[model samples]
Target: IALNAWQDTPLYNDKERAALALCEKLTLSQNIDDDFYLVLAELFDQPSLVTLTVAINAINSWNRMVKMFKPTVEFNER
Candidate 1:
């Protein structure tokens, strides 16, 4: 139940919320609020935060490139 309804459940911790908030900003808004940085600072160091942000940006960029290319996906359904 917790896994299924973490957003509404008490199982959702601050760290998880912080991560989700960060991802939401990157994916949806493309601009982060000052509060988001404060939360991130609580969870990660300066270097780690920079690395994580860059990594996420890189992954999003790669996803955009792949989507633009529209390559065929071959999946084996077992």
Candidate 2:
């Protein structure tokens, strides 16, 4: 709920907001401009930034796989 309205809510700090913005842009295939990069750099160090990018990409890839495969789960009664 709060996350759905992240921009409006005050629950997130600057770093979280920046990360969320990056996630949204990456997920939506939107362009990440130089200014946004600067914002991210200011908020995170180089290694941290690389890790965040990798994590976001990994999640996106997993989402794509799930959508394409539509894997099912089966449960057994005890």
> Whole-model lDDT, candidate 2?
0.97
Candidate 1 residue-wise lDDT, 5-51, digit = tens: 55677767887766666766797757776877887998989998888
Cα lDDT of model 1 overall? 0.77
The regions of model 1 sitting more than 4 angstroms off are 1-6, 9-12, 73-78
Best by TM-score: 2
TM per candidate comes to: 0.69, 0.89
Instruction: Give me the displacement of residue 75 in model 2, in angstroms.
Output: 7.5
